[model samples]
Target chain A: LAKTTQPISMDSYEGQEVNITCSHNNIATNDYITWYQQFPSQGPRFIIQGYKTKVTNEVASLFIPADRKSSTLSLPRVSLSDTAVYYCLVGDGTHNTNAGKSTFGDGTTLTVKP
Target chain B: EAGVAQSPRYKIIEKRQSVAFWCNPISGHATLYWYQQILGQGPKLLIQFQNNGVVDDSQLPKDRFSAERLKGVDSTLKIQPAKLEDSAVYLCASSLDSRLAGRTGELFFGEGSRLTVL
Candidate 1:
């Protein structure tokens, strides 16, 4: 599995844009970058996923550089409720398969304050 | 659709005692997993199952921990003679298909089962 590097924590004010970047230099060719947000006492929820370039959805946007060595998760107009730990995982997302799977890192905890 | 389900939200047991945790994945998901999360750390995969077959269990401590997903549906994780270090949240997650060997979406996780070994 490819290892990932990201910030341990980040602080943001309401209405501001927040971007969390993760570096996975050894990422596999078939690996996809995915981000999940986890609130206190709850399981992580999928936010967005991308193989390359950029992908956006109702909740967030993902930017993958040309090298695929790193990626960023962008959240717009953040609110206090957005406070949670965000995990950046790189994998093919094939559940039963083996080799170069997803490894969960200590996520970047974002604190969205009032 | 129903989400993954886990039970006995919390557990407290004495050292050397045994305990078990249960999980029910979303309908139609063929893959299931068990992870251990110590406070302040990201979850670590303890085992993985493709239906009723074991996919990977390299991280599980064989002497103490065991898990089974019978009939490829609900699953159970058990630890015999729990230790102090076993005091962590046991998490259950389900995914639609296999990754490298199989084929889909990110895993859906259930609220974890917190365990405290006294």
Candidate 2:
């Protein structure tokens, strides 16, 4: 399992774009980067995932550089509802069927203010 | 489709007492997981089950915590002589399958059972 490091907290105003970066210097070739968002008293929800390059979804976008050592999660037009904890995880895409076993870092807490 | 279901939304018990939490995964999901989330921290995987079989339990405190999935559907997690540090939210999540090619490894989670050890 690759160890991931992210900022402890971030603050943003409504309608602003927020970007959270995660560093995994030892990421392996088969490892895929996945991001999840968790709200108060709720379970973590999948935001986006990518192995390399950029992957965009309705909720967020994931950008992975060529070295695969780092990845960024970009949230567009943030709102108060977007304030939540974001987790970045790296794991072997092929064998991580039981994704629960993947290690979860402390995560970045995003505070969106109106 | 119905998401994962968990029971007894809240539980309060003494440090030496025992408690149990139940979970029912989504229909057709082949992989289930039990996670422990302490306040202000990310969830930690306690165990993972592939259908009715245990796939991994390295982080589970086997001496005091145990979990089982029967008939590849519903599951139960039990804690005997719980400790103060055991107070946290117990989350249950499921996925279609573990294989990456077969699925995206996206998990559907239940509301979770909040446990307070007094």
Candidate 3:
């Protein structure tokens, strides 16, 4: 189990880029960093995931440093619809499935103001 | 492709009452999961099932909360004598594989069932 720490909340105007970073000091060798976005009253949607370096998708980009202790989620040209709670998770993806659970933290609430 | 489906998008009951939530996973998905999310918080995994068999349930409050994924496809989560703390959105997700030996794909989630315990 890896505990992730991220900012509690952030405020930004529309058309701005928002970047949220997470820290996992004890990330395991087999861990994978993943991000999720949750809109109001809806289940979370996967944003991006990466093992190391950078991974980009249509919605967001995930950046992982070489140490694997920190990761960042960059949302380009965020809009009002992008205002949601974002979660950062680090997990030993191949660990004991019986004991390994994807525990979500408080999450960073990104509020895109108009 | 059809996404995961859940029934009773909203549920309201008094404390000590019983409630149940139903979920239908994506076709051919072998793994199913249940999660609980409080207001303004991230979703928390309560249980995971692999082909009708429970794989992990460490976070589930077995005394009051129970879930079953029968036939390895659809699932049901029940709360007996629901508590105030049980007031949250119950989410269901399905994945192709989660055994750690195969390629683990992303989870497809349902709209979720919101429970309110008065």
Per-candidate chain B TM: 0.95, 0.96, 0.96
Model no. 1, DockQ: 0.65
Model 3 stretches with alpha carbons more than 4 Å out: A92-99, B100-104
Model 3 complex DockQ against the native? 0.51
Better of 1 and 2 by TM-score: 1
Runs of candidate 1 with Cα error greater than 4 angstroms are A94-99, B99-103
User: Of the candidates numbered 1 and 3, which has the greater lDDT value?
Assistant: 1
Alpha carbon deviation, residue B104, candidate 2 (Å): 3.0
Cα lDDT tens digits, model 1, B8-117, are 89999999999999999999888899999998888899999989999889999999999999899999999998999999999899988664432446789999999999
Docking class of 3: medium
Interface RMSD of candidate 2, in Å, is 2.9
lDDT of residue A77 for candidate 1: 99
Looking at model 2 chain A, which ten-residue stretch has the lowest summed lDDT?
A92-101
Give DockQ per model, in order.
0.65, 0.52, 0.51
Relative to the unseen true structure, what is the C-alpha lDDT of residue B104 in candidate 2, on a scale of 0 to 100? Answer: 52
TM-scores of all candidate predictions against the true structure: 0.95, 0.94, 0.94
lDDT of 1 by residue, A6-104 (tens): 999999999999999999988877677889888888888888889899999999999999999999999999999999999988875433213356688
User: Which candidate ranks first by TM-score, i.e. highest?
Assistant: 1
